[model samples]
Target: MSSDALWYFARGSGVVSLILLTVVVALGIGARSGRPAFGLPRFAVNLVHRNAALLSVVFLGAHVTTLLFDEYANLRAVDLVVPFIGNYSPFWQGLGTVALDLLLAIVVTSLLRHRIGVRAWRTVHWAGYLSWPIALAHGLGAGSDADTWWLWTISLACLAVVVAAVVWRTSAAFEARTDRAVRRVEPRLRAGIR
Candidate 1:
């Protein structure tokens, strides 16, 4: 297609990827929250998370490919792997590169989770949290239409959803930890072990 069409396709893919990434993050947090929904089971939540993550990856591939093909962006293939190595809006594009690298690591470790061990997999998975924000920043800073109201609305909504999920996760973790501490202290007090 023409350069203009290719550019539009790239921008569209990037926006869709961001939306999918938000879904993946929300599903992951929801699953971890451990609250049973009306009909959706934990397994289903996990399955959706995994599938959405894969879908996001696919869109990301499209975004990268279209950008590379669009002469206007001037993004070299190597820029996809190596951060800050691209001539295209170097710093912002580099953030995208870093986000992509983190995502790849998350995906590979997830696929190999059984063999690599749960602890290792979890450690890598935390990088997903980092990747999401880096990607948002890249999109906001690098895109030509960042000033558009629609993009800003979507970005803010995504941010709100993720932030809410994080707050839920953190409170749940803290509560659980406090419960365990209380349990430990109660047993010691009863046993006179002070």
Candidate 2:
């Protein structure tokens, strides 16, 4: 394909990847509550989270592959793994590289969760929360369409949803803790303890 086609494909894939990543993040937070989301069962929410994550990976690969092939991008293979090494906009590209590395670690640990154990897997999975914002910043700083109204709309919307989901998750966790404390206190009060 032509350089222009490759560049366009890379841009499109990158945007799609970002959107899918957003979905994965929001669904992941929702899944943690062990409650239904978007009228779907808990299992369905988890299923969508897993599938969205896989799709984001596929699109991310496409974005990188297309950029590597596009003559205009001037992206070297090493730049894919190493942060801040690209010829064009190194800092912005480096953010993407860092996010990619984190994602790779998460995916690897997830595949080996059974062997590595849940505690280790959970630790690695937490990196997903970190990667999302880094990836978002990378897109804003590195993308040629960064200033476009459509890109801004999509990015802002994604940010809004993720932030909302995080707030909900934290509140739910706090409520659970409060309930446990109340339960403990109730029993003590019933026994006439001070």
Q: Rate the local accuracy (lDDT) of all candidates.
A: 0.89, 0.91
Distance from true position, residue 39, model 1, in Å?
7.2
TM-score of each: 0.84, 0.87
Model 2 ranges with Cα > 4 A deviation: 172-194
lDDT of 1 by residue, 150-180 (tens): 9999999999988877776677664685577
Candidate 1's error at 57, in angstroms? 0.5
Model 2 clashes, total count = 0
Which stretches in model 1 have alpha-carbon errors above 4 Å? Answer: 34-39, 170-194
Q: Report the lDDT tens digits of candidate 2 across residue range 31-65.
A: 77565665678888998899999999999999999
